[model samples]
Each structure stands twice: as C-alpha cells, then as structure tokens.
Target chain A: MQPAHSNTVIEASKLGLTFQTSDGPVRALSDVDLSIGKGEFVSFIGPSGCGKTTFLRVIADLERPTSGSISINGMSPQQAREARAYGYVFQAAALFPWRTIENNVALPLEIMGISRDERKARIKRTLDLVNLSGFEKKYPWQLSGGMQQRASIARALAFDADLLLMDEPFGALDEIVRDHLNEQLLKLWGQTNKTICFVTHSIPEAVYLSTRIVVMSPRPGRVTDVIESTLPRERPLDIRESPEFLAIAARVRDGLRAGHSYDD
Target chain B: MDRFRDKIIPVTTLLAGLVVLWYVFAVIMNAPVQRDMDRRAGEDPRFSEFIGKTLAQAKPTLPAPHQVATNFFENTFTRKITSNRSLVYHAWVTLSSTLLGFAFGTVLGILIAVGIVHFIALDRSLMPWIIASQTIPILAIAPMVVVVFAAIGVTGLLPKALISTYLSFFPVAVGMVKGLRSPEILYLDLMHTYNASASQTFWKLRVPASVPYLFASMKVAVAASLVGAIVAELPTGAVAGIGAKLLAGAYYSQTIDIWSALVAGSVVAVLLVTLVGVAGRIVERSMGGRPA
Candidate 1:
C-alpha cells in the first residue's frame, strides 16, 4: 500500500449493478463499498458471478452502477474514462490479430492521438516493462499464451495511467507461467507505482499480490470481508509457503466459504 | 510424384470417367437423327460405320466431347480476333462488363454493410430490401435494367454493368454485414474501455475483421457478375458478346457455336473465381495467413 499521506484513487459506496435479461433481473453487484489508495495493489477474490469483473468494468466505465455512487480520483467513472485516467487489461489478451506486439501496445496511444515519436517511445517502454521487448515485431498468435497476456499488460501500461484495472489477466496461463507473471507483475507494480485493482478467482494469487483482499460472494453479489496483508513490502515466491502468508490466505478462503452458499 | 498421385490422379480419373460416359450418351441421343439421315441416302452400313455416324451427327442432341473440344479450339484460336466470329472478342466484351459491375457491386456492398453495421435505421430499412432484391429473377431484372437505362440515354457498358452489380452485390453485403459484426463482445468492450470513437472502432476493428469475409463473398460475387454480364447481353441483341453469340447460334440452330460459347464462359468463370481465390491467399499471407 502507498503511504497514508496518499489520496484515494478509487472510492465506492453502496455501488450496485443489475443486468436486465429476458429471464429476469440479475444483480451482478450490490452494495460494494471499497476505497483503494494510490500505489496500492488490491484484489477482488470471489467465485463466479460475484461481480468481481463487473466492479472492475464499472470502474473502467464499461458498466454503470445502478445505485449509490463511485468515483475515480475526484471525477465520476465516465469522466475518468473519458479523461483516460486508467488502463484496463481484460481476461483475454484481446490483441488485434493484424497488429504486431508493439502496435497492439500502441493502440490506446493511437486512440488518444499521441504523436508517432511519442507512441514509439511509449510502446518500447511498456513492452520493456512487461519483459516483452524482443517480441515487439511478432504477432499475438506467434507468442505463447503467457506472453500474449504479458503483451496485453504492456498494452494497458502503455499510456502510463495512474490506475490499472485488470480482470483475470493471467487466468488462462498455466501455473508455472502464472507464478512467473505474478512475480513479474509485482515487480512492474513496484516500478510503476500505479494503483492496481485486480479481479481473480485464485486464492493464492489474491493473497500473494494484494495489499488488501476483497472477498465477495454471489446470490446478491456483495462484499463479505476485506483482509489487509501483513507481509513485508519486499516478498519472494517462497513467501507463499510461510506461516504468515498461509494464515492470511486461510482467512481469505474462510471469508469466501462463509459467504458462499454451496448447496444452492 | 506424391502430389501427382495424391491430387492429380483422382481428378484425372474422374474426368476420364466423365468423358467416356459423355461419349456413350452422345451415341444414344444422336441415333434416331442419324438413322433418318442414313435412310434418306439409302445407305446400308456396317455396325462400326453406323456407330461412327451416330456419334458424328451434324446436329446431335448432345454434342460429343471431342466435337465440343474441336469447336472450342476452332472458335478460340482459328478465327481472326477482330472478326465478330472471334470467341476472344466476345469473351472480352463479356469480361469487361463483368469486371466493371463487380467493382461497382463490391464498393456498393461494403458501403451498405457499413451503413447497416453503423446505423440502426439502415439495418432495419435496407437489409431486408437488399435480401429481397436477390429473390426477384435476375432474368426478369436484366431486361428491365437495360430498358430503364436506355430510356434515360445511359447506354452501353453502364446499363449492362448495373445488371452485373445487381446480381453480385447481395453476397458481398450479407457477408460483410456478418463480418463487420464478427468481433466478439470482449474486443468491443476493450474499445469501450479505451473510449475510442465510432470511426476509430470501424477502421481499427471492423474493417480488418471483415476482410476474410469480404474475399469469400467476392468469389461468389465475381461469378454472379459474369452471369449478369451475359444475361444483360441477351436482351440487348448486341452481336458482339458471348451472350449475343449464344442467342444467334440458337436462332440459326448452330449447336456447335452454342456449346463453344458455353465452354468459353465456364473457362472464364473458373479463371475469375480462381483469380479471387489467389488474391485472398496473397492477402492471407500478407496478414500472416490467419486473417482474424
């Protein structure tokens, strides 16, 4: 987490979203209250349909909250999105097939009408940050799944937005790749000092990466618990095996099971 | 050798089988006509002579394969190219109008697809009409297009090309409509997150995504354009095109000329579609062989 002197990057109060379908109304998110400080790594951990992704999308202005209010920095979500205040990484790489890795990363910069020289510079910097510098000229299909996801992260990072919202960016990768990416992500987060709101279903992933974990449950789709990590700022992959890490992970798991209705 | 054994062998065997069967049918079909001709001459011929006579009838119901091949060769290479009798001249006339119509049809189809994709009003209003237009006989529309354009003093290539455009545009419009909308929800949502403008989304997302679809439809459209060009020639009574040649041949009961014109048309159709396929492959390679 950033120092206590830092301002809140994201704030939500009783935020709700209900999707209307032919079957009926489905409450994807309800009464979600959370505030993320600058330079913090926060993870929303939940089972399927718990609105973890919905909340992230809401912050990105891809979905609007039906009730209460949420703000990014001082502006509303729509305003923040329009201002290009945050970068979003999706579940899939979502790379355009025709574009090379560097060009894919340059997408937002192109949209924002950045100059050619600046776009080239930012593309190089972001690709380097994701450790994808050499694969610049290659297509998305040419790379491995993990590499594609990393390229996608680089794409989100290209604009240098103060906030980064990622929705299961590494979910499709294998465990070994996931662990390596998790480590690389934490390092990248350290280097960039951006506030990151990540959504994932993996228990260890949330516990390993987040400064604070938001455990959610379905049915009405609401937050049940928030666990602040007690680990040191500097951590290694082996930290997951430690008693302190396991204890926090167990608390997060319990919070999840308590809120989840397995019978239903 | 493997390529020959695996690919060419099957194709050649099927073709050989077809030719043999065609020869058998030719004899069966021409026998009655040949019998009347031979009887008029009071000829009593051997079995082989009788068989040869049936297969070589001047106006056989179904011309033998060799007879059609000979006609194809004579009309294609033997005649002076400047003469109206030249198959090359007729083929060129048909080809020129077909190509012009195809170009217009492709541009019109893509425009309609874009309008349908971007505007709800066009999607609701134009798409059904675009689809419904195809159901009316091209034969019915071909003459009407010629008449209407002639009435407006828009004669020659434009009217005939308009018919080609009419026939070719439907497949492209439908294909491109599906292609433009082919991007998944996630990709669109990615654009939404970026807050990209409508035009940016169209160019960056829709256009590239629709290319493969465009080429697939183009192959179908080119063949249709050729048919449209030929059909357009039919009502005009123009004596310079393959369609006119077919009409004149039918008028004079010159069965060999009709067969040769048809053979020429088939060869042109194959060439046009194959040309499109090659273009598609080149594009596919340039885009790294996977368009999507």
Candidate 2:
C-alpha cells in the first residue's frame, strides 16, 4: 500500500455538470479542479444554489459530470463506487422507518453479503463510535433528529471505508447540537483517519471541522479559492474564536464574496 | 381496554339500530299480503296477530331477520355438509374458488407492478389499459367469460378463479406500483452508493417498502375475488355454490332461501377479509413495521 501522506483519495479536473430540465438546461457545476489527499478533511462552502453538494455527488458517482474527468484512488468514480471505496451521508438521515437503528446501519453490509457475525461486530463497533451503543432497538422516528443523523453516520462507517462524503448532515439540527456534533465529528476523523469531503453553508462549521476549505460560487459553479487551515488537528469548540481560525474563516468569506461578482 | 371499548360501543349501537329498522321494514312490506289473506279467509285478523304473521312469513317480500337467521341455521347445521341443500357446502365451494383466484390475482398484480415500475414504456402504455379493464362492468362480462371458458373446455373452479383474478388484480397492480415508487430519491441514492445490484436493491428496498401497500391492496382484492367467484357461478348455472342456491331460490320464489343465502355470502366475505387483515398484521409485525 502507498504511504498515507502520499496517497491521493480523490482527483477532479475541469469537471462540469448541466441538468436538462423542461424549462432549460441548468448548469450546476463548471470548471472545477480539486484533489483531496488521504486523511484530509476538506469542506466545500458556498451559497444555496452553488454546486457544493453537486460536486460531492459527482465524487460519489451519484451524478455524472457533463465534461471533464474525475477519479477516486486512480479509478473512475463508477468503478470506485462499485468497489465500495466510500461511504456517503446525506442531508436527511434517510433511515428506513421500517428498520431499527442496528438494521439500518447493517443495510450496506447486508447488501455486500457479509457474514452475520462480522456484521454484528461491525455494527456494535460503529454504533459505539457514534456514541449510539444502546439505542440499536429504536426506530429512526423514535430518535431525535440529531440522533438519527448520527445513526446515518454509523451506517456509513459500518463498512470501514477509507473515504466519507457528507452532504450537510447536520444542517437541520439546532446550534447547540450542531456544535456538539461538529466536535464529535472532528474526533471521529482523528480516530478513523478517513479522508472526508463535507458540504456546508456555515462558515464557522466549515472552519471548525476542515483542514482545508474550498470556496465555491453559484450559477455554473466554479472553485474560487482553496484555503488551508493552520489550526491544530485537535480543535475544541472555542477554537472558532481563535485568531488563526478567524483568519482562515475570513478568507473563506472573502472568497465567497468575490465569487458573487461572477454572476454580474 | 379503553380503546377497545371505544371501538366496540359505536359498532354495537349501529348494528342494533340497523336490525330494528330492518324489522320495521319487514313488517310494512309483508303486511299487505297478510291482510289480503285474512279478508279472503273471512276472518278479521287482530293487529297483534298481523304483526306476528309478518315477522314469521314463509315467503315474505323482505324476510324478517329471525326468519332468515332460522333458515340459515337449519341449512348450515341440520343438514350434512355433503347435502346439496346445505349452505355450508355451497359456501365452501365458493370459498375455494375465491381463495384460488385471490392467490393468482396477487401474484399477477405484483408482477405487473414490478414491470410498470421498472420499465418506463410499460408504465406509459399498459397502466391506462389495466385501469380501463375495471370500468367495464363485471356482470356484463361474466357470462361471456364463462361461455368462452366452457368452449375451451376449461370448466369448474379454474373458470371461476379466472374471473376472480380479473376483478382482483387491478387494486394490487395499482397499489404495488405506488408502493415501489414510495422510497425517496435519497434512499435510492444510498442504495446506488452501496453499488448494490438491481435485484439487491429491489429485494432489500422496494419489496420491503411495498409491504404495507401490498397488504392494503390484498384486503380489497380478497373481497373483490369473493364477489367475482359468486358472479362467475351465476352465469355458468353452476349448481354447487351460493350463486346456484340464489338461482334456485329465485325460480321457486323462495325469498326466505334467497335472504339466507345472501347472509351466508356476506359472512364468507367478512371472514376472508378478516383473514387477510390478520395475515397483514403478522407479516408487518415480523418485519418491524409500525403497530396497528
């Protein structure tokens, strides 16, 4: 295996996607070039219509690019997807209401045809990682919104994939819960050492969790700037108030503001 | 216990009220014949005697509840099950056809639904035709179906089952289509990200998601199948089922027999529907679905 620091998990070049609707073609992403290295926590931050989520979708092979090529670990996204290279967490928990938490988390594993004993062990370990150890018997509706999202994360982590693609997984939660989850997520990253691509609209959230932030603009989305954070890997909630964290966040904000002029 | 009481009380009250109204209507409708008989006999029948005769007529226009019940009890219990006059025997005959047709209909419906959901062309082309089939009255077509089947030498239970299948498959097809498509795009994407095979996605996601819809449709389908079986029997002039009993009653003007056969048919329908409901509860619970 390649050394972790030298391994590149994702690579994209001049990628573009345009959706053809009855009204007309809507350009969701354009001219994007990005490379995410192993163990990197990258945040894609932009406005609502911006292609942050679309870019992640492209990486996950859920959506295809209209132009340019992208690869995960030197393979096409489709091939990589078929190989189960990454786990994806959506904005909504999206758990099957019919399935209990344990069963929901075990879904992908079951699809992969893993043995029951192995599935049980992984489920227990992953649920513990998300601090959801005892709530396995409860259904998604029985849990709080935050807890549901965590369960979804556990589902993604169950297979021990090296890469994770999260699309605003906590956007629906309140401030207090979001803050708590942000810290827990950072700790999760530290423990698993998985490369993460997160999409968010919040500046502090992007700054607090990411080792690097890619600022994007809407209307044929293009990458405006990519800012590398100097903040330590072990960041606390109060780190959001620190000067180094503020400096990185200010840069992301400025990049976003600069991209708005592209529409004019 | 409180919830059970809440449901039982209203149902009991409604049923009692219905029985009272039925008794009143029976007395009014049968009164004229009784009075004419009294005049012909040159005897002035008292009001009390008239009321009693109306409620106990041998061939009243609308059979009294007790008269129908007594006839039903005698036919069902006093006669051997093998007797041609036994309501129990006729009910069993009709019920066998109903069950066979219901199974065939459920299977056909699920297949059609899977096709419609999976193939866009089928959805666009076949769905409207399936719906239009239901618009033609079953009564108008039942005789033709029986005659056609007889010409082809397909007699007995199979023909009746085919008719039931025709009537019952529509609901299952429509419901299964809706259920298969009920999963959100996010869930579909989740499956895609897992790189699950098409069959895997269908069995794990679509089929399980469609369970509630399937059960709901089955309830309707079972009732429709029972009706289809009865209708199928009527046109074929079959002499072994409830439909045959009705035809014989009509020929002899045995209104009491007709009413008793009607009640027996209704009881069969209720039992079939209840069986489907109980089955749905068991499957849903085992699958960890919401409690009823």
Candidate 3:
C-alpha cells in the first residue's frame, strides 16, 4: 500500500453514504478508503446502482456523505467546489440547445467573470484541443451526437481546472467513435497532466485509460478491488491486443464478476 | 403547389363554407318578418320577389351577408378615420388601450414569475393568487374596475387599459413560471458547480430561456387585452371603440352596425396576434433557437 503522501489530490477515510427513499434507506456507498495522487488518471468501474457515479458526485459536492469523511485539495468537498476545484462531464452531453458551441464553452468563463479577451482565447484553445474549432458557431442540435459530446467536453475543459470528474463521458458513443475519443482523451491527459477521476461500466475502458482502476460492487456499493496498471504510458489503439493489456483487462473483468452476485 | 393544396385549399374552403352558411341563416331568419310586411301591404308576392325582399329587408332580424359586408366596407374605408361612425376610428380607440395594457401586463407577469421562481414564499403564496385572479369572471370584474377608477378621478384610456392589464397578466405569469423553470437539472447543476450567484444564474440562463414563453403568453395576452378594452367601453359608457358601437347598435336595433363593429374587432385581434408571433420568431432565432 502507498503511504498517504503530501501530493495526494484526494483523500477519503472510510467514506459512506445512505440515501433515504420511500422504500427505505438505501446505502449508496460504504467504507470507501482511497487516496488519489495529483496528475493521475483513475477509473471507477461498477455495474448499475454500484455508486460509482454517486462517488463522483460526492467528490463534486453534488451529494454529501452520511458517514466518514472525504476531502479534495485539503478542503471539504463544498469548499473545493466553491473554489472551482473541478469540472464534471455528465453521462449525456447536457449542452444548452440554444447556445452555439463557442457560447456553450464560454458559459463557465463568463460565470467566473473572466474578461472578454481571456474568454475568447480560452474558448479558442479548448475547442482546438477538442478538435471542434471549425464548428464553433453551430448550435448543439445542429451537430452530430459525437460532435455535441465533444463540444460538451470542450466546455468542461475551457476553465482548465486541475481536477476533471467525468461520469461515463463516452459511454453513449459507438465503439469506433468511443475509441477515437479515448485516444484523444489520453493525449489530452498527457498534455495537461490533470488528475482525472473517471467513472465507467466498461472493463476495457477502465483498464485502458486509468493508472489505477477501482472495481466496485452493488448492494451497499463497496469497493471490491483496486488494481494498479503495469502497461506503458505511451500506448496505441491496438495495444488492447497486447498480452499485458489483456492481462489487466481480464483481472478487471474477474473483479466485476466477483462483485456482481446474482442472488436477490 | 403542395403548400397551396395542403394549407390554402382547406382554409379558403372553410371560409367559403361559413359565408354560405351565414347567407342561408339570414334568409331563414328574415322570412317571417318579410311575410308580415307582405300581409300589411296586401301584396301577395311570387317566390323570387319574396326571396329578394327577405334578403334585402329594411330592418331584417338577421342581416344578409352582403348587407353586413357593404356596411363594414363603407364604414371602414369610405368614412374618414376621424369620423365617429367609421369602424376604423373605433378600432383605433380599442387598439391603443390593448397595446398599452399588454405592455404593462407583460412586464408585471415576468416580474411575478421571477419572484415566484426565486423566492419560496412567492412560489407558495403568490402563485395560487395569480391563478385565482383568472377565475373571477372578467365581465363581473370589469364594472368594478371602472367604478373604482372613476371614483379616483381616473377615467378614459387609463381605466380601460387597467382592465386590459388585469385580463392579460394571468397567462404571461403562468407561461413564464413554466418557462423560467424549464432548464434541465443537469444545466442547473452546471451552474451550481460554477458557484454562480442567484442573480448571475438568472441573467445568463433564466432570462434568455423565458423569452419564447414570454412571446407565446403575449400573443394570448394581446387578444385578452383587446377584450378587456372592449368590455371596459361597455360599462364605462365610452362613446368610442367597438364596444360602444355594439352598445349603440343594440339600443337602436341597428344589427348591421353591430356586425360591422364585430368584423373590425376581429381584424384588430388577428393583426395583434400576428405581430406578437413575428416578434417571437425574431427573438428566438436571435437567441439560437432552431425553427420548429
């Protein structure tokens, strides 16, 4: 086990969360202890109702934990959120239908009171980073589903926050487009060195992008395993066929299967 | 050509059908009155003579379509706009009140909607009252508005406008409430992540989103404003506007005059609604709303 280092971007101590519903109190998360170092890409892999998304929301301050404690950059989740510590990408693009691609990206900058010149420069830089520069003036509904999602990513990247909480950002895309986006996202992570906390259900995706993959289980939503990656940092799309990559993927698949017990 | 067949054909056919129905009704209603006239004159007329006389009665129970059409044209185009007898003059009097009242109503409604959306107290207490305001029949309320305003020595255009304001504000408030709250939860969460202040969220997000709803509500409101104006004219004993024309026509049994005034009112309503629609389209387009 790695010691709790000073460079840790996130730290949690036996974190737990329970949601009170009409049926009863549902334990969305339980006894989650983890620390993520700065500039590392981490993936949380789980099935439906496994609280992978819930954990991300907790980190983003969208949900509060009922037990234990969690901190981002040595501050409470709410304080970090108020300080503009991270950017979150939802499962869907969630772009405003009436805003142009450029304007959608500009939304955060404008809210943060960035000057007009700085906003313009950041919008250009982020859209270029997402390969959506030529389509800035187009409305969200005018674009293809993939392009819309890219625009949404550019919007999240516009502010250049050090932490990016992505909840299944490419989950809705076709395999080909998802692969393409995955390559681009890996390149982006290398270029920016941001600490990315990604949530996904795909085993390959978790093994492919993450420096460490946290496999989780449903029914009280606890972490089953955390696997550190041994693959090279500079990887191509075909690296999935490599023996080392497949070995990690097989381990992740076993972790998932072990967590998903069929008994009701 | 396809548009002509799809849209124009149905619309014109329906209109022609209505005109034919009106002519038929006019003949049936006037026949009894025409029979009494022949009996008094001791002139037993033939079928053609009786039909002609029924359609062209001096004081028919229901005037023929042609009679009302001619009266409307003469009063609208032949008479000078300054003339009291001109339908155009009366229509102008009512339209001014409608426009003024509609403007005030839209502002008031948007303000109320903003309050209801932002403040829980307003949402709980004020929203119910806004809805309850609409249930009180405008006809019953019109007279009291005029009476109260008259007691305060406020008369003429302002009182009639106040009545129009009362009738028009309800739909604007209701539509805006739905519109201002229309943003998705994801987008609202996006705003929250930015730590956007309430006013910031309002100006950058809520205001632009509420526009389409504003224009839709205004279209209904403009028509309602016109109705309130006409109704105000009825009770306040105003000597101008379509309402007064109807009142005067009824007092003297000049049914042709009543029908012509009604036609003028319809034209005004169609104009106002169309104007609002055009304004809405321009705004939504400017705000990046795609054409539906």
Best by lDDT: 2
Q: Chain A of candidate 2: what's the TM-score?
A: 0.96
For model 1 chain A, the run of ten residues with the poorest summed lDDT: A1-10
Q: DockQ, per-model, please?
A: 0.72, 0.72, 0.79
Pairs that clash in candidate 3? none
Segments in model 2 whose C-alpha atoms lie over 4 Å from true places: A1-6, A261-264, B151-153
TM-score of each: 0.97, 0.93, 0.98
Query: lDDT score, residue A119, model 2?
Result: 99
TM-score of chain A in every predicted structure:
0.97, 0.96, 0.97
lDDT of 2 by residue, A1-264 (tens): 223235888888889999999999999999898889999999999988789999999999989999988889988889999999999999999998888999999999999999999999999999999999999999887899999999999999999999999999999999999999999999999999999999999999999999999999888788999999999999989988889988888899899998886545
Native contacts retained, all candidates in order? 0.67, 0.86, 0.78
Q: Candidate 1 — what's its lDDT? A: 0.91
lDDT of each: 0.91, 0.93, 0.91
Cα lDDT tens digits, model 1, B214-245, are 99999999999999999999988777788999
Q: Pick the candidate with the highest TM-score.
A: 3
| Cα lDDT for residue A72, candidate 2 | 92
